[model samples]
Target chain A: MSGTALTQQRDLFARLVTLGEEVTDALDHTNVVSTLGEEELNRAIAAIGDRALPDAATSALAALAASVERVIAANDPHRAIDWIGMQPRLALTLLAATLNPASLPKDVVPPSSGATVAARIPAGISFSDAPRDGRAVVYSGIQADPILRPLAVAIANATPAERLIARAVMNDPEPTAAEAAALFAALPSHRTTTDPLVVGALAIGGKAQASNAQYRGAVVEATTAEMLRRRPVLANDADRLVRRERRFAIDGVSADPHPFDVTVEAGPVPELWDCKWGARGIDASLLAELEDARIRAAGSSARIAIGVVAFDTAAIVAARLTIVRAPREKTRFITLETLGRLAAG
Target chain B: MARAVSTPPDAAHPARRPARFATRGHDAAAAHLATLLADAPPHALLIVGPRGAGAGTLARDAVATLMCGEPVDGGPCGACRACRLIASGSHTDLVVINPTGESNTIKIDQIRALAAGFALFSVEGGRRIALIEHADLMNEDAQNALLKTLEEPPSRTHVILAAAEDSRLMPTIRSRCAVIRLGLPDAKQASELLGERLGVDAPTAVRLLRMSSGRPGPLIDAEATGDAARAHAQIRRQILDFAATQPHARLGQLGALVADARAILVAGDDDGNAADGTESDDSSDDAPDVDAEPKKKSPAKRSAKPTPAERRAAATALLRLWRGVARDLALVSTGAVDQIAFPEDRAEIEAVAHRLPPATWGEALHAIDKTLSALRRNGNPELLLDAAALSWPTL
Candidate 1:
């Protein structure tokens, strides 16, 4: 290991010793010797290394060790383990950095930016390389890192969701941006990223505001569709009933509606278009609106033709669509041939 | 087999002997007497069966033979004065107890009066004949009152009791007397009887004979009264209507009629009401016979109620109507007839019936029988009725 890694490991060990001392003193003496014997205590001490310790950490560890020994001698080893287990603040400090690798400072600097602290660490000195050392670093880092301390506090207090997140972080790799977004969406909190690290990353990506904005837009669109679907005058056609383009000003002037994400040729033909994504095809109601549009375009030099468009994440494709006029009504149904052509495009 | 005891001279012989039942041939009646009546004799005869099964005719035949002064072969000599009086229904000694005011049962008063006649010594120094048309209807008290007379019957007495079934009477009452069970006649016999005896047309005779369910009397009654076709039609309509409404009612009607036949079966030997007396009280004389036989007193048997049997017969009649409906529906479905499906409720019955398979009609008939049986067992009549009505299988 490098000199800096050794120094870090040593520092983590000193802190763990202080924490163990605090836990030991807080407990009775018999347990300290009998259940968490000298060898186990040494192991726990070694595992924690130089993690951070609180003010009464050293004396508390000594007292707690003594108590664990008493409990074991009294034929209650589980009590000794439980008594020590109750020191969650100490435990969280021990695990936070080691278990949650993402919380570590990014070693690789961003391209075209200054050198990063993460780049200084050698490649693949994996989190498990120094398990004993890693725990101490986690404990110390949690105490030192302002952003991680509250999470550590939550873990120490045993909040259910925080505990779940801790356990998940312990067992799995750090979440990606998309996964983080899903997590934030599921969480009941309305506040934005509280952690400076998460806030900085989100601001850099310009994603925090965009995600919330998209959610609102989706909600509004869904609500409008639901309202239209419920209206008897709409005849169960959500698309035909909701014409968002008809927004009017107090002057009774309305903005001309540009076809949504489409281009039209002025070939003496008025064009109608329907768009959907992933080739899922257009709603049946949209075809009816196109039929009405065709009628409105009649008696002009413009000969109207209906258009169907299918879209993927990349780009949209357009195709000529065949409309089956209603036998009774003037509305029409777009044929499957039209849908196929759009998908091919 | 017991020989056919001749009627004494005092008893008048009808000019025409009573008609015979199919089940109770002359031989069985004689044998029944040999087995049951030989122990304690009877002075009067009672006859009972379904109306046209000829209980009256059978009684007349037996009485005339017994009172003919001299009988030829086991039959009466028609030319005798006794025969003439009995045939004319004017014989004083040959008494009959029929229901009063179209009542289905022979009341205890009627039976008691008949007993008075049996108590009197015969004026002609011979057997005094009394025939009861319906014997099983005697309630427990009436049957009990008649016990002593049946146990130690008078001398110079020859009784012939006829019925359609032996089950209607108490076993105690049944044990005391000879039993003659009458059954439906064969088609040819019924036809011949209807045409030759009643002077009905061939077609009418054939229809009446078949519709009479093999009882010549119903046929004769129908012919004489000129209401055979009409009564049959009315019964069919009633059955059809009631089949849809009250399943147990039909069965109760049938059971009541059958019970009446059974009741009268035990009375033929005790009273002359079975022949032509119309209303007589001989049932009181038989009541004591039932009470005295404590061993035979069935606690399970309540008053001899024929309602269940009558209801069952009525249900059977309903089934018969369903059979007609099934035939008509089948004909219509197969293009064999252009007539309305159910002439009474043609529009609706046709609509529903046409949607059902032909076999559903048969199922409906079977369901009616089941419902009848269920009702007789004291099951919920409404449930059975609904089940029977809906039992028609779908097409």
Candidate 2:
């Protein structure tokens, strides 16, 4: 193959793989959008009926329909079930076509009734070879195949162009400039260039920015730990006073104790501190740890302080809100700027 | 005939005695184990390493040292009554548990029995040691059952868990045990050991060492290792031949490729199962019959037809090997021949690499990875293989 043709083939291969991955992710229920309910499902089908799909999506939908028909025609129930389960969008399209044959465009047609539709039913759900009358039976069969519902939901909720963009971004979390350009070129021109999905994909696709953010996070963590270690109370007896990435046994916590970023033992009460770089770093798990520490220190004269030292003001606020249940006196939600004071106190 | 002098009972079956704990290229881990045995050893110890890297050997040796009447240089003397019994797999106090039955998992019942046994006094008035081989295979309930014993074991009891993949183990179980990680042994030591064990010359031993990736487990099992190596060689040739064919004709080679890959995996498993069987028979005869189900079922499974799970596992293993081949081709194409995995098949690899651009090899690798991912999710093997074959660059 010529160089240009080879490149184009590679690009096409990447897109197909990305779509497969997204379908798998949807099956695994890790997609950003949740599965559509009965009402929403009907609305999506109605909306799709009115919209004029791009040539690529129309072809893709048609291809999925054709593939389903072929698998059913092969008279292999196993193959038919597997083929449908592998692609959520295909399963959705099939279900939509079965529900309302008139809803889809003339180019894409649902599989005809008889043994073809009967074979498409997953064997796990029903072994009966009899043709089902209602859309309910077909819907139930699709539901029995675990990947179909969530995948169909994700596909139906998002436009074809949007799903394509999402899959591309998902495939390459950190794409190079040239890769980003190629991705943009592949996207349908109908979708607005200024859409948030397009803008977000471009922003995150910059490999340098992702690496820089990671580097900065590491630097902040190290710097915070060093500053805490340099405090007068913690300086003289370094080993005993400060520990990094250490897990301490607390009474109430079950299983293994979480490894705190920094643990200071110089004060009367032991202090476990975790350093967060940005607002996104503050989460529920951090709060649970603080609460567990609080429970362990209950009814004791010496109060163990479970803290989070965040660099961002927003993170500190979020941490404070997240740990509202924990006693204020027993918790230390501070910033790096106040690390020295907190350590000294 | 001259009057026969009376031999000691322990010396009656000298050939049957357990071999002294010996390993190649795990000096630091061995030393640490020795130190722990001599001093206050942890109640629970986790020996983490790849399968065939000698984690099982290390764990067994550690147990022997703990139970030995006379330990020499922190190892079992192999002459004492305890050592003799342990070696012969008749030690009353030593218990070994492995994944058993069709599921191939260490179940909660087996673990509960082990815990129950530990609650009692030692049979021979020495330290009671339990070695859990392939501990990573233990299901969640089994791991949880083991956690209580790991946290607070009875006096004079030590549990050693040997696992190929430590990540499969629960964090609670891992945190409770002192971990000893075994890595690839030193090249010189491994080569010498392989040579001595296989009775091969230095150059052949060196080649075998490289092929086994410096792992003593595969090298020591000469027959299985040899079979696997031969299968791998055949696979390299097949890949090259397939690459030379037209795109449409390449599908014809899929069956041969899959069969060759499965052969390689089965060869490794045959040796592994044999080793496990011997160990199980030796240990279970004297210990409690808690793992009786697995013991009874393993031989039958071995002789019978392969289960679907086993076939899937073999297919997964083959895809992994194919991924490596694709990566090696890319490396060879980029003039990094030294980094290629199959250095022995350099000529064939070069011939294949010459036909495709380095980028094409990368694409092939990606395609294989996607196929592997799909297979793991229980996709139809035939369909996935067909797609993979179509994706590869045609000569």
Chain B, candidate 1: TM?
0.56
Worst 10 residues of 2 chain B by lDDT: B276-285
Q: For candidate 1, lDDT tens digit of each residue in B1-395? A: 13223332222322222232122323344434223232344443444445435555555556666667655544556777877776687777766665454334556776677667777888776667766554565556656655555665666655455444446666666666644544444556556666776677776665554443344453343233224344444544443353243222333243233333232222221111111111112232221111011112121342544343333333333433444555445555444555532344444445545564544454454444444444434332222332343223322
Residue-level lDDT tens digits of model 2 in B12-63:
2221222355765776667667766666677788887756667777788888
Off by over 4 Å in 1: A1-345, B1-51, B100-103, B224-319, B323-362, B370-394
**Native contacts recovered, each model:** 0.00, 0.00
What docking grade does candidate 1 earn?
Answer: incorrect
Interface RMSD of each: 37.8, 22.2
In model 1, state the lDDT of residue B265. Answer: 25
lDDT of 1 by residue, A300-336 (tens): 2224445443221100011111111221122211121
Report the Cα lDDT for residue B164, model 2. 70
Q: Candidate 1: TM of chain A?
A: 0.21
TM-score leader: 2
DockQ of each candidate relative to the true complex = 0.01, 0.01
Instruction: Give Cα-based local distance difference scores for all models.
Output: 0.37, 0.52
lDDT of 2 by residue, A1-345 (tens): 122222232233233333434444233221211111122233334334445544444433444333334334444432222222233433233333333323221111112222211112111111112234474364334324433223323322333333433333322334333333333333333333354444444443332533434433433344445555545545566555665555555342221245566666544456677776542354557767766755655533335667776543211232223223322323455532233334344
Badly placed stretches (over 4 Å) of model 2 are A1-345, B1-19, B191-212, B218-222, B225-227, B266-307
